[model samples]
Target: MNTLNQGSQKYDVAYLKQTIIPGKTTKGQITQMFGAPTNEELNSTSTSNESNWTYEKTDEGLDKYMKLAHKYVSTETSLKMYETSAQLAKAQTVANDVSSVTGTKTGQSQTQGSVLTIYFVDDVVKYYRVY
Candidate 1:
């Protein structure tokens, strides 16, 4: 017999969002304040400013996994983005480097937003956030 217990924890996206003011803050600054971000972007423009910085705090899900004896897969519960012109510039640089290395196209048609998806197979994490 298997019993499941999901432990509760505090998650505040608003508080995280409050840590920085977009356009004024850089990705480095945001990371310094909030630690390494799950993701980072650079060289993008925002309505408020010409650049943006973003990060996400994902639930580790270990607690839930253990509770269910690793039987269940979880999806992202929440996500947030931060804006900074400096960060956007940096992200653009990094993306350029990646494209150069992979011989991929320099620009994507969709500039507004990027989507990430994670795939699993046989109850194991396979690939994630493949754009």
Candidate 2:
């Protein structure tokens, strides 16, 4: 399967909520449930080394139609579609502006993905955050 497609896979959020307990859950269980983390970090503290594991899922597709629409459509029309003027302006800028450094148009639509991060100290879960 294409791991690149975030919407293609299903994650058990409820199960994660029930299982991930700070100070109780171990790194092994986390690895078993979610497979290997996408990223890992080592943090140094006064006492010992701490570890952070991040599991991320992203869904990205080229928004060709939106790009085309933005290029052809008027600002007034784009404003109606966007929620705010700032958003419209940013969209237009991204779609149209050529980067002075890269010399490439920098417009693309990307939906932010969900991230699960577990912080570990002494081989046990110290804290976790989901965003």
Candidate 3:
């Protein structure tokens, strides 16, 4: 049998658009919705002093497999069961060995995460970008 498992953590852009308004949303409101930012920076420009808040998210994928094989080695071995007792013995030996052999294989993949940068002016959201 084979199996696959995938996991991820991310932000909702549409939800952000609805919740974060350029002139109305405050730093406290953004923090409430997204938790603490991954990183923060302050900038002083000719006309404005602003802050940049960065948020990040990641995704991962995985694949798993199981393999099994069995072999029976006996002096009394035959292809026709009813024709000979040797065939029955060989069949029994194979059935007995079936539980002893097995193997497993696993594979994994990952994707680069998404990043969102929110620019704040006077503690209010000025603009944002997602990549």
Candidate 4:
């Protein structure tokens, strides 16, 4: 009998929700933890003086032509630092309380877990964890 173990590795909720953080952490530290980032950007000159990084991961699984049975998971994490140290602590707090969920399917039925982490510094979402 064929088992799911032998199936190809595909992107799924399990792989997307792995980037969540719960404490004081910086973009540099997160990069070290998850390797190179997928994208990076800085806030507008009018906005805070800080940079953001986005890390993305994707995988393909099973073939369901009925409605496209490929799994794709992407996560974008952003971290920013201000001119004052006071903002640093708040930024870290906002980056630690993020959660999200995303998925797609067609004819057949697939039960996929939807879990996302939204990092917040000072109680605001800064980074996002999506699988």
Candidate 5:
């Protein structure tokens, strides 16, 4: 399978939620754990010196389609390699099932990911959210 990255890093949201605590975790500590952010920006709309750091991972192309194609091809090939009637019958059944499933259409969602953003102020985490 292929992977597409929209930013500099990827993150396990569950781990982040459990580890990173607002008003507790320091910016230095966050960097030590998750590495550099995809972007660093000051929250212009806010009067305080609040900053936002973003970490994002996005979908890869053709992964779903390739998996479906591989399933169908492998099942059909197994039908030819089987020497016994029972094996062949099983292979045929598998092949039939695989054949009926269609690949994803264009513009269909292949995978899903959420951007993990940490908001900081005074070099400490103020709050965090996934967008």
Candidate 6:
């Protein structure tokens, strides 16, 4: 498939909302919840002096290309590949299952990534935004 860039690991919006709460969540909690952020800024905005912790993952919708790739790969699972026959076959089967719609539908834009920016003042979460 044609991928622009793999970018960072995926983030779940629901998980973030459920775990993090502004005014109550602490920096340690945020860090523990999502691990080290993708980036950090001393002063993210001119108007605010609060430290901004950013966790981001970007994807430009791979549904179409992924579908095409799935269609192509499904037809090749039986064929012998570079990897060991057992390993290759198993890998191919799993890949096909994800796009086969029996498991995960990778050809959906809803599998998009997220960018979470949490503004901190005195180690407590002042505000947060997830895009």
Residue 11 alpha-carbon offset, candidate 1, angstroms: 5.9
Runs off by more than 4 Å, candidate 5: 1-10, 44-47, 59-112
Cα-based TM-score, every candidate:
0.27, 0.48, 0.49, 0.32, 0.48, 0.46
True lDDT of residue 101, candidate 5: 66
Mind giving the per-residue lDDT tens digits that candidate 6 earns over 50-77? 7888875532234334445555674565
Per-residue lDDT tens digits for candidate 3, residues 83-130, read 454576688666545533432221111122367789998889899887
> Which has the better TM-score: candidate 1, or candidate 6?
6
Residues 40-102 of candidate 1: C-alpha lDDT, one tens digit per residue: 343334332232223322322343344353234333221111224347769988887888788
TM-score of 5: 0.48
Q: All predictions: root-mean-square deviation over Cα?
A: 20.4, 14.1, 20.1, 19.0, 13.4, 11.5
Candidate 2: residue 131 lDDT (0-100):
59
**Predicted candidate 2 versus true structure: per-residue lDDT over 1-131, tens digit per residue:** 35434331213445455778888999998877677777998887537668999876541322334445667779988766555646877876766544534656322222222677789997899987765
Error of 5 at 108 (Å): 22
lDDT for 102 (candidate 2): 62
Residues 1-131, candidate 4: write the lDDT tens digits. Answer: 22422222112444334444444555555545555444655555624444555433221121122113222322221111113334865775554333112333321223232222334443323656444
Worst 10 residues of 1 by lDDT: 1-10
lDDT of 5: 0.63
Which model is ahead, 3 or 6, in terms of lDDT? 6
Q: Model 4, residue 107: what's the lDDT?
A: 16
| Model 1 alpha-carbon miss at residue 46, Å | 11
Q: Write the per-residue lDDT of candidate 5 for residues 1-131, one digit (tens) a residue.
A: 23423222234545556788889999899888767776898977777788988765432233334434456767766455444546866886776566556542322121223677889997789988765
State the TM-score for model 3. 0.49
Residue 130 of model 6: what lDDT? 64
